[model samples]
Target chain A: MTDPSSASLSSAETDDGAEAWVDPERVSLKNVLLPLLTFSVLLLIWEAAVWQARIPAWLLPAPTVIGEAFADWWRELLTHSLVTLYETLAGFALSIALGVPLAVAVVYSPVLQKTIYPILLALQSVPKVAIAPLLALWIGFGAMPKIIVVFLVCFFPIVVSTATGLTAVPPALMDLIRSLSASPYQTFVKARFPTAMPHIFVGLKIAITFAVIGAVIGEFVGSESGLGYLILVSSSQSRTPLAFAALVVLTLMSIVLYYAVEYIERLMVPWATKT
Target chain B: MLASSSLEVVTTAGSIDRPKAGARAVTKIQIFDLYKTYATRTGRTTALQKVDLDIRENEFIALVGPSGCGKSTLLKLITALIKPSRGKILLGGTLLDKPSREVGIVFQQPVLMPWRGVLDNVLLPAEILGLDMTEAKARARELLELVGLGGFEDRYPGELSGGMQQRAAICRGLVHNPSVLLMDEPFAALDAMTREDLGFELLRIWERHRKTVVFVTHNISEAILLSDRVVAMSPRPGRIEKVIDIVLPRPRTLDMQFSPEFKAHSDEIRALIRRT
Candidate 1:
């Protein structure tokens, strides 16, 4: 059947000329502009409130003061930010390397799933922040503790998503491969894995944001470096503006990393987005 | 009387009693008292019981019945996707234990890999079989062209219409040059016009290839239009009630479906199915 919606959409485009064609672009522009405008208004009100109330800089710094503090300590902040970025990437990579195979095993073997799935769920239920201190105690205060903690935090989501994805093959698709007398390995490599890619990416997206939090928590427990440590030191020293600057940098980093996963997902499995 | 004994007698007698025109046709598949029982959490349900059929080479047979008549179960059994509880399936006089390369299957859904383009999807069996990729690619291209999807080879499954995807799936089932093609309600998901169009396309392909086809469908007209034999099945404890031979001549057209002979065959099968 001719798609009624698409037929109407094309007709609307024709009737409205370039305007209908540009509708999505216009919406995207509004999306960005509206958010920025709201943020600017909030910042203006905060600045006016701080100034009019004669609040001390140590209590609540104005937006301009925070910006100036960010510029003044940009070099130090960049160094600490790089440290946090490294820990996040390293831990996230470790999670993928370990979690995927574990997920595969869980999906393929009922024995392993029955035995290990509960353990994983239990482990995930435990507050990750509680384990950070133990990890720091065991691995020492270097990058190792931070990386391990990040790995621990990111591991569960990847494993769960991967397992779900691997097992979610449609019965029809499974039948298609099986009717070919395909070896189990061939079935997995060609059909199951490719089908699971979108799901795996979803896990990666969630795990990545958690990886940032994990790294920061690792820093909070022990690390002498990283943006988390910078925030800790600045706030303790009553350098509120510098702490806000470090927090802002950390937020930007998390956004960048999340999008990076999304970008790769688009490249690897473009077909998934359409479905 | 055991179905297996009768099946054996029929297999030998049919080969010996072949007419001069049918002399070259040999038995391609022989099912001896095949039975399938599914064991669920509750208990066991018999899907097919005491089914016996002998399929000739290059013959087109259609399995038609009400829903849950084990038409699909029989197809799966023939393809060796699932094991039969009791019976022997012989391919060219050899006992079949697993999915054989000589048999290809098309399910109700196209089941095309969304990631792979149409050409790659058709070549999937070759890849799984580890055949020569270069030759498989050439055959894939020819099959695509044959199916009227000549220029759409590079397109993904999502990009194609439902009918086009099913056509591509049919090309996939035939790409390996299998001797027997098993289709389980392949066009059941398409619109009426698309189904008719695909039916004609399938007949054209069968005319050229002459592969033994075992098609399962609920549509009585579809069975009469495309098959040399229509096997009517009973529901629940699925059993072959009757096998009606269509005497309609080859290269059958869509208009032939409205003919008096075709109507007689259709009515006869419908009555047989309704009786039980």
Candidate 2:
């Protein structure tokens, strides 16, 4: 309701006509240093608490111990991370490949929407964890099973978001396009699709996080590789630091992928996402 | 039944007023016995009850009415956005039975695609119409200049003021060069000064293009200032209550709006609307 775009656009424009908000000199060092300093203090407290309390290293290992475990198993951790990354990437790609077109079809055709949308919603509601074992059984516990499980997890959000984006065009906008004698496809490509980009990105970002978790679940069910497998192997052998190291890598992977999608969304929909 | 009979008589009477050009009547648009009804929760409510009108080519005709008087509905019917319950709308010599590119519509809102630059926004119609990209781009640049948006071509709709955005919408509407330009309160959202400026600007554009414009507005003065003829309508079962002809000379400006002639016509329309 507020004309936020106008306010922001004008404020961000500098006297010399450059966008000054992105200037490093304007960004306070405190903004970066404060967060880092706080995190370091928390880590020190964690190490001191463990030592003073005489806690077993297996229960909650110190940062130095975790670093040692990380260095010792660096090769295995990196290898497993790659496998998980590939599975997640493959599943994410396949889901997008299948979901976007299917969403377009569903949104464009009432018949397909009426028939398939409810079933898709039902699939999403079903805990995909329950189906991991069945997938492992059918796909023979290789990358295929993990990939399929990840695909199932990621597919719904893309479909739902894409469909919503397609349908969310303002009625006035549609009328404006229609008055030009625009064909259905042209209306979609020109007006509806661009307008829906922000909403579609919402679904994509949500799916990316779930995609990582799904890949981990696939590894948990039956896998010779992946962070999930490493965590399982380390915990079974009381190698908590090793498991903690695998977890740190997995969290980093998820955050990095999620932010990557966010960055693209920002670049593409700069106008719509001013809020 | 009585309304339907009267509607038939009105349609015939309206056609008789049509000036024939060398035995070939060159009416830009013809609405014969137009009626539109909406099925509401309670019952069927008649929005427009058997309306008939004949618009001459290159004439600026204003359809002014009260709220619920079906001015917007009539505009939609003319643009082929909605079908009439019983009637025929003819554009040029061809009956506009379906939505076609023959008419360009400017809605109350700018409705520009926010994601697109001002240049791209103006080219929206061409994109949807699938015209030659190079030609459309050329025409879009021309239109941007025509609308006084030459320097701000790369700016997005979000970057423009409300007045500028509406101006861009006008460019988009006229880009396709349709014979009939349908405007539904396009300047109603603008401030007073901007709206007046745009009204004169539109008049200037109309003089240059000489296209038939069916302008819909609720403001009596706007209708009187811009229209060659002002058709006033009643509320509810929308019916044409009066039609006042402005025999004022061409190239009328903002000052003309305060002239005795303009005020007289404006008062005439105001009285007619109030009576409705």
Fnat of each candidate: 0.58, 0.64
For model 2, how does the per-residue alpha-carbon lDDT over B99-134 read when each residue is reduced to its tens digit? 878788888899888888998888877777778889
Output the lDDT of residue A196, model 2.
Answer: 75
- RMSD over all Cα atoms, model 1: 3.8
Residue B4, candidate 1: how far off, in angstroms?
A: 10
Worst 10 residues of 1 chain A by lDDT: A1-10
DockQ of each: 0.42, 0.36
Poorest 10 consecutive residues of model 2 chain A by lDDT?
A1-10
Q: Please write out the lDDT profile of model 1 over residues B41-153, one tens digit for every residue.
A: 98999999999998888888899999888999999888888899999999989999988999888889998999999999999999999999999999999888877888788
State, as a TM-score between 0 and 1, how close model 2 is to the true structure.
0.89
- Report clash pairs, candidate 2: none
TM-score for candidate 1: 0.92
Error of 1 at A114 (Å): 1.7
**TM-score, second chain, candidate 2:** 0.90
